[model samples]
Target: MLSEFKAFVMRGNVLDLAIAVIIGGAFATITKSLTDDVIMPVVGWLFGGFDFSSYFIRLGPIPESYAGSPTNYAALKEAGVPLFGYGEFITVTINFLILAFIIFLLVRYANKAMARFEKDEAPAADPADVVLLREIRDELKAQRGGQ
Candidate 1:
């Protein structure tokens, strides 16, 4: 059983999956930074400086005014407020779309690259000598009434 587990872990598919997961984590961080730090700021600037993260609807027993800005969703939740956090959702959805598209592009390029590598790596055709030998043998057999 241990050997089987080791074999499974060492299989190409498993190794590929592990690498993909690590790469995906890193890609997620990059996309998150792109969205949060770069894209969102541009979006906000275009919309007259509207910060989406701060856009939420309060629903529970909380004052209309909070003394300090909440740093994160947990802080707002801790404030005993039922909230409609649409802005965060929108941001997350945008991030997901961007990540998915980027992955798609990567996969597409990888497939194309793999195809090109396969074409390059394909075994060359049999030598002309081998081909001529086979043809001569066939002709001799035909002449000998071997049909």
Candidate 2:
């Protein structure tokens, strides 16, 4: 059973999948940073400088001990305030779209590259023994036909 498990884990596909998962996680972090730190801020600036992440509707009253800014979504959420965090959702959605598009492009290019490799490969030449055998067979056929 242990050997079987090891074999399964050691498969080419399994190793490839593991590597893809690791790369995908790192890529997701990059995409998140791009969305949160770059794109969102630019979009906010374009839309009159209102931060999208802070655009949440408060669903419940703030806690008495909550000393943070009332309009702060992260602080309010951390303090157990109920919120309809649509801005955060929008940011996450955008992040997902960006990640998905990047992965799609990678897969598309990878497929194209693979296709090119496959198409460019010529068929293997016949072995020396096979070529000799074919020549002998052709000679035999010629002799028989002549006879």
lDDT of each: 0.87, 0.93
lDDT of 2 by residue, 1-111 (tens): 999999999999999999999998999999999998999889888989967788899999998999999988999999999999998898899999999998899999999
lDDT of 2 at 17: 100
- Maximum-lDDT candidate: 2
Clashing pairs in model 2? none
How much is 43 displaced in model 1, in angstroms? Answer: 1.1
My TM-score estimates for the predictions, one after another, are: 0.80, 0.83
Please report the candidate that would top TM-score against the real structure: 2
- Candidate 2: where is the Cα deviation over 4 Å? 124-147
Task: Quote the lDDT for 71 in model 1.
Answer: 45
